[model samples]
Target: MTLRLQPVRLASGNDDSEAQLVFAGNALVAVLTHLAEHHDGEAGRWFMEAWFGPGYVLNRPTFASLDKAQDWILERLAEV
Candidate 1:
């Protein structure tokens, strides 16, 4: 399966505005937000802000990078 990421800025009214829209084919799978300095240890990581479909829910995990987030999304998609 092929996944595409579109860079976007979320109007979260905070430092956590940088985000990406994750798409699987024509369907939107998830939204990933970049953690800010306020997150302390998690700062600079990518956080799963939202998700669609089954198997996509995983307690809104944070990834060290965009690649890892995409990998996790693919794994979840494969399970369904």
Candidate 2:
């Protein structure tokens, strides 16, 4: 299976903004890990919101392997 990376632009007040994306699972994890390690809390939160959506519900087993995560995302995409 192939995973796609789609770009997203987020607006933060007037003139301020940030850019992010929903990438292939591995890519997503890599990006998040980098942000978590390097960026401050607000930046990390912004990235998470873009990736998971604002009303995202986090259940148990909050994270998964890249392949599993990609599959899960693809399944959800199919539903929409």
The candidate that achieves the highest lDDT relative to the unseen native structure: 1
- Give TM per candidate: 0.94, 0.33
What is the model-wide C-alpha lDDT for candidate 1?
Answer: 0.92
List the candidate 1 regions with Cα displacement exceeding 4 Å. Answer: 56-58
Cα lDDT of model 1 by residue, 1-80, tens digit: 98999999999999999999999998999999999999999999999999984654657899999999999899989988
Clashing pairs in 2: none
Q: Which parts of model 2 are misplaced by more than 4 Å?
A: 5-21, 24-61
> For model 2, how does the per-residue alpha-carbon lDDT over 31-78 read when each residue is reduced to its tens digit?
211123234443333223334522343551222333454555566555
> Who wins the TM-score comparison?
1
Least well predicted 10-residue stretch by lDDT in candidate 1:
52-61
**Local error of candidate 2 at residue 18 (angstroms):** 18
| Cα lDDT computed for each candidate against the true fold | 0.92, 0.40
